[model samples]
Target: MQAFTNADMSDKGATKPGFAISAWPDTRDILARLYDLANKEPVLAIKREQMERYLGYFEHKCIKSKSMTSAAMELIPGGVQHNLAFNHPFPLAIKKAEAAYLWDVDGNRYIDFLQAGGPTVLGSNYAPVQEKVIELIRECGPVTGLFHEYELKLAEIINHYMPSVEVFRMLATGTEAVMGAIRAARTFTGKAKVIKMGGAYHGWSDQMVFGMRIPGIGALESHGIPAGCYEHTQECFPNDIEALAAMLKNNEAQGGTAAVILEPLGPESGTRPVIYEFNACVRKLCDEYGTLLIFDEVVTGFRMGLGGAQGFFGVKPDLTVFGKCVAGGYPAAGGVGGRRDVMQCFAAGLQGLKKRAMVGGTLSANPLSCAAGYFSIKAMAETDAPIKAGKAGDRLTAGLKEIIKRRDLPFVAFNHGSICHLETAAAMLMDINNPKIFTEVSERKHVMEEMGAAFTAEGIISLAGSRLYTSMADSDAVIDDALDRFDRVLGSVEKKK
Candidate 1:
């Protein structure tokens, strides 16, 4: 039909500046661009190819993310849920993970850099922790519906490490503990308002998700969350105490602001690591207002030091929520810890320890999770695992810095401990006023992801975003292995022409 139309149009002597049919060439050009967009270099096409190439390797990965998605969709809205975990590629279905390795449904092995996004500080499936869980499973059953010995032991170890946790309560996720801490703060101080640093991710709950680096201004990413809930949850810029003070003072008419929540190191995402003064000012502000402060240490806890960011920064929050290394690499563990009076609201009986906060889940403190956690903490405490990881992270971070310096790549690497945090040379890649950093993130991001994929294709696996981690299992050999891959990937991305 197009040919016939072209013939008819041609027969008309290609009527110059005349009929509607004469504009056929321009229409064809537009259609050609659209077709290119579907299969070639336009935005959608480029993004799709990236996703396809990346995810297509999953069958060889031996993990079945599809099965996980199918099972989760029965109860979750988007197969498996969580916004950050979502990627251009469908998530890989994970079947088993052990000692820095993962097995997918397709039975392929991957060196894991996700490390549960920074929780597996000691490496996945440590032998002692696994043995402890198995022993508990065989002897005491999975969950008791009553108190277990491991719970108290675990808390005792935590208290030994962090003095801020005078009293604490356990839950299943960092999200749960964060929400609980907010409730405790409000209940203890009789205040309704809270403050959070922008770009930091505390949890997924509606109340805490506001103003958290949503890639756009004043727009919250979480759906079904009531604006009324965030009306009192003020968002402040990190490292700027004045902005926080202004918001607190400005919102003073909105009722009492009970708490300020921050990461105490960096805002966790979308920004670089911060300095100590940044935290000190916020602590000073909290002290001035008589408001309780909460540190959402889901990322920094234990990974930073024995006391996590509190020990590292020497600034403590009134309440702290911990996950990640607190459970080693096991399932169903997270908790809230802080001053006694605040935690008193959650007692089980008539006293503070026994008073019910009217929230309970059969699995909130389930025994299997507690068992794994108990050993995880105990094992980390006994061995030099934390220190080992920290030292390894230092080495890896140092090597990266050397690479960047030598290659003159626009990249920077920093680490608090076993975690690798990096940012692209994009601050140098585009003009200062590029309208949208995210708009170009697709093209520029491929350079890093392809680098990562190449790293995986080599012998080591790294976090999907170029983040790396060191584990207790990591040694001079492990470090060399990862660096070989790292050298290869880094060489490609920032290689001098």
Candidate 2:
């Protein structure tokens, strides 16, 4: 892979019209800082008394949430339906969301840095998009189990913004889209093996559940999944072009590789960011190896800008996986798009063809989701939501760095436009080969969980206590307020004995 240069950074860092990231993150520097923090002894953590007070907020102010979750635990596994909802102490039941805020069942408003897992770039419950969805629902209901005009509109808009996406096929979720993309790649290339960067999450599909979250620990979390499911799935460390090439070379003797799928911004939305030129290098390798490249843009589809990371990086993959902002935070928000020849493998209806990749969803491309997505993209373009959101992220990251410095903390902070990361414990950066990986991860994770609880107590909602996705609704005032809250939380941290 090519080394990053000042010119390279200048070229891609301009936040061109339609791109979300105002500046690409310094991947090498960030990684070095994170690794240093990970190797340090006596992890910086919230003081025990401070953590008790933060937990007290959950016990006292969140009484209703606790009661509701306690009752729900009897029926719902882990007391939450979604992974994102599973908080440290207990999940808070959100009653309302608007702009950059969320109101819990107890009527406590929080700065919604989670942004519905990076979908609502225009902010939570954006009025214009919500009104369009309401109008559509009132006219035709949410789903009709049949053709919808908005589906075509949504696909057309996607193609317009992403010309490389010659055709689009809507699905119900990012998982389904990944399944479809992989199947299409196999059919198109007549190969069965697939390669993904270790630690990159494509979704929860059986074949994709391998090497999740932390790299080099393949199938550690694949409890219910059988070994046969991921026999053909291979993983290589992120940004290691040589390893990827070697894997592709090895696959040639084992029926060849069908596709190389990855989250364009790196695993977990840049939690493990890639160098600016990494995607281009991957694209070249895919062409050389006769493999399809699939960009999983579930979080970056519209949030990273209308053109997404692909457009911003000037790299075109053979297939693009869409989710999250695809439906503008609406349900059933996912799809796959790519070269015309490859996408034809998913041609709907029974048409006798040499090959076909089967995929189905009752609610896929329903009227409600389509309308929501169509209007949301339009709104994002009209208001430059991605750019505005990116600016907000820049402000938040800058403020976080200042706080980390002022507090003399070892935490690292950085951002790729709207997606920001604050690495307090560096739990995710732990080396896989460490003798006490699991034990260290657990200890560091506890610290992270405590940090998340502290943020919540300070009236801020972050993803996993590390990631903060800023939206267009996050104005300078909102960011400043969040910074104040962040300052409080950071200031409360102390080295764990």
Candidate 3:
């Protein structure tokens, strides 16, 4: 099959494809130039000053949020439940969220760019989805510890959109889904070692967390994890086909590779992007090595398109791990889907299956989550939320690019559908092979934190101060307002320089 590219989709330049197959060259060029500009001393100083101003503003405007965060720290470690919750000054204690806006405890309002960490592609507390969820709760309740029709419906919708998924099984979180996908690959191939792209996050399972964040640092974050847990996990550079082939060849000599897994959009949701034909290249390599290719579409699944990245890229994988938008912005959103033979690993009491991965979650395929997922997919299809949100992302990207150019700032802005990334500290894309990896990350920590604070101060919420996920609710007007805020922040930083 021909490798998918921006030209494959009708809306080529308007919105980048989920897999970024065609846009890789331009993306790489821009990233290289931005990285060079960001590393300059003057640029770093200006970013530092901007961060201080925004963080100070946050401190002044969010007194109530500050108090709540302090109280939360007593009960919750780091004063936040999730990594995304802790912002620059202090995590905002949100009182309510609707559509594309959030209200903090201080009654301050901000445009919602985090999109609930990429789950709420339809927007946070989207009314139609909430209406369905509420109605389901009132009728049959949340769970029955038994079967529910919604499970079947949800599976059907997923299969409809993602044809590679001949069978499906739900899990509670993306991490569980990754663990299950890896287990299935290993079981089906009867192989040991698994190869994942460097800097790709495939959830926090002990085995899958081998190369967290920075690549080449084997199990550096494996604090309590036994060394044996990741003995078979190997890493390869993103978009480097020869490196993958070498790893697979070495693994074959070692014990054979079970699976070649990756986030289709490259590591950290395209922070480290791959070339246009990277997915197709990897697919060929996996086939040659008799290794399963698993696409961790937790962030790109439903949001990318109805067909997800696999469909967008026109390259099917042996297994697919899904999360976020898959659950329809509800809690407990994760699942594994793929060929029936391989997916049978998760089945119980099936003697015909030569191997079993033994995967199950008590809350897996629960009624409420499935219901939300089913209706969510239905809503997405009817409204074309993915395409609409992608357009919104396109507008946001264009606006940010314009802002950067106008302010003469060294930054990069781009999007894969509604998943927009604004990269300032391009230096953070650390060279995994470098011995000074820890120092590299530590030196830029303050600047990164400050950028995030500046966004928050300007009434914008983002993922880690770098990435922003737009939603279907982000209409032209909403995006324009967001652009104005972005312009303010960009201008502030540029003036400091």
Candidate 4:
């Protein structure tokens, strides 16, 4: 074995002190063209060891993310299910996701700001929902398209809370519900065309995939999307009442418009904030023109609390599409809830069990999903979980805001209840020293890579370049822990300056 002294290694190991970076603006750009001199493969089995090593030197530690990411690519396609999870190296693989934290396979824990992208609003493996699921599964049946008590229970729960829902039905996914909402609206109004907000993501269904954002710019599709299939979904910008009004008028004149759909609070529009006046104005227009307005609440539904986003904002829509929080972080759940007149179209065919609507999923209203959803909502109401989660979101984001401000860093953050996220375009703009110069899509992407690695090292798992959600299970202590780690990792990103 060889033993080395500080002076010996310092003299021979690295370049002399005060070596300048020559003017590299971003750490990512530098990392991009650089290669390691040593074999990093040895680092793979040593993460748990590395974490211990760091903790020995300091009181805190986290995963490197690089090793875990490479491992993920071998197991899962793109290293994740959600589109935003396709970060630079690749997303870290989860060993476990419980409560408000994720443990990567490398054994590093992260405060789960991603919150399973929102379905885990109550947090992963919530006790009440889990208990209910197990109890129901053992006692009776988990799936029965014939009918189940939980489905009706689920319907009544939704009807009791949302003002717009007089009658409703459930499905297995948000896209199913959203597409059903569109189909029902057209059937009820006898119209063939629909309008959708630009940059809003309803689902992966072909019809609704039109006009999505590609690095903050609206396009028919990014890749693997057919222009012809999405042609009927006329795109309008969020919060742009004028553009909306014009589109509605033109469609009405053309006599083909049936419905208008949007994410009530879209995170994809590059943080274009929605105002009270704008939503209220939209409601008035919907009523005046007899156009059915659909609030695609996949990200907002139970997440905005018992009343969801419509009630939270004091603006009700004719039809509402829900998912995410409804399933309590489980598989198979979503639904369309709304006015009796529109829903009646779906109710038409059943005798005692008539089916008026064309939407049907073998898993639609399955007992398993219904039981999960019922328990999720009940848990929120009973524990005041939504409010608690919102507070968590507020604290986490507020801390992040303070850190950015104190560091004089540029970034934007906004929250819709417990769901919160950061947009790093401002951060990139600041780094470029000119907001105007942060124009390229590639610049924003480069920044995402840096943030992902930094957050992973800080014991926090975030989404995309800049997005996160607070779960009800995150108490103040958990929030503080994440914030402290965030503070340190951000400092590291800066030191790499």
Sorted on TM-score, best first, the list reads 2, 3, 4, 1
Instruction: For residue 84, give model 4's deviation from the true position in Å.
Output: 5.0
* Residues 1-497, model 1: lDDT tens digits: 01111112211112221111111123223223322322333221113354344455544452456567657778877765654344333455667788767776666676666677877667877887888888888998788788987788778878887899988688888888888888888888778898887666787788877766431233346578878867667776545556677766665676667899888655663133453355656676677777888987887777665676776556778899887666666667689998888888877666545433544667767678777877776677677576777677777777777876776654656665676655442321232223555566566566546555555555456665556766776776667666666665566552333
**What RMSD does model 1 have?**
17.1
For each candidate, give its TM-score against the true structure. Answer: 0.79, 0.97, 0.92, 0.80
Better model by lDDT: candidate 1 vs candidate 3: 3
Tens-digit lDDT string for candidate 4 (268-355): 4213334434555667767767789898888777776778777765678989998876777777868898998888877735557433
Model 2: per-residue Cα lDDT at residue 137: 86
Q: What C-alpha lDDT, on a 0 to 100 scale, does residue 428 get in candidate 1?
A: 15
Candidate 4 colliding pairs: 346-356, 346-357, 348-356, 349-354, 349-355, 349-356, 350-353, 350-354, 350-355, 351-354
Q: CA lDDT of each candidate?
A: 0.64, 0.90, 0.81, 0.66
At residue 242, what lDDT does model 4 achieve? 73
User: What's the TM for model 4?
Assistant: 0.80
Q: Candidate 2 — what's its lDDT?
A: 0.90
Stretches of model 3 off by over 4 angstroms after superposition: 1-25, 34-53, 350-354, 433-436, 494-497
How many residue pairs clash in all the candidates, one count each? Answer: 19, 0, 0, 10
lDDT-best of 2 and 3: 2
Report the candidate with higher TM-score, 2 versus 3.
Answer: 2
lDDT tens digits, residues 1-497, model 2?
32333234321343476787766666778887887888865588888898999999999999999999999999999899998988989999999999999999999999999999989999999998888888888999999898999999999999999998999999999999999999999999999999998888899999999988888989988999999999999988887777787888888899899999999888989888887777887888788889999999999898888998999988999999999999999998999999999999999878865688999988899999999999999999999999999999999999999998887788999999999999998888776776668878999998898899999999999998999999999999999999999998898888554
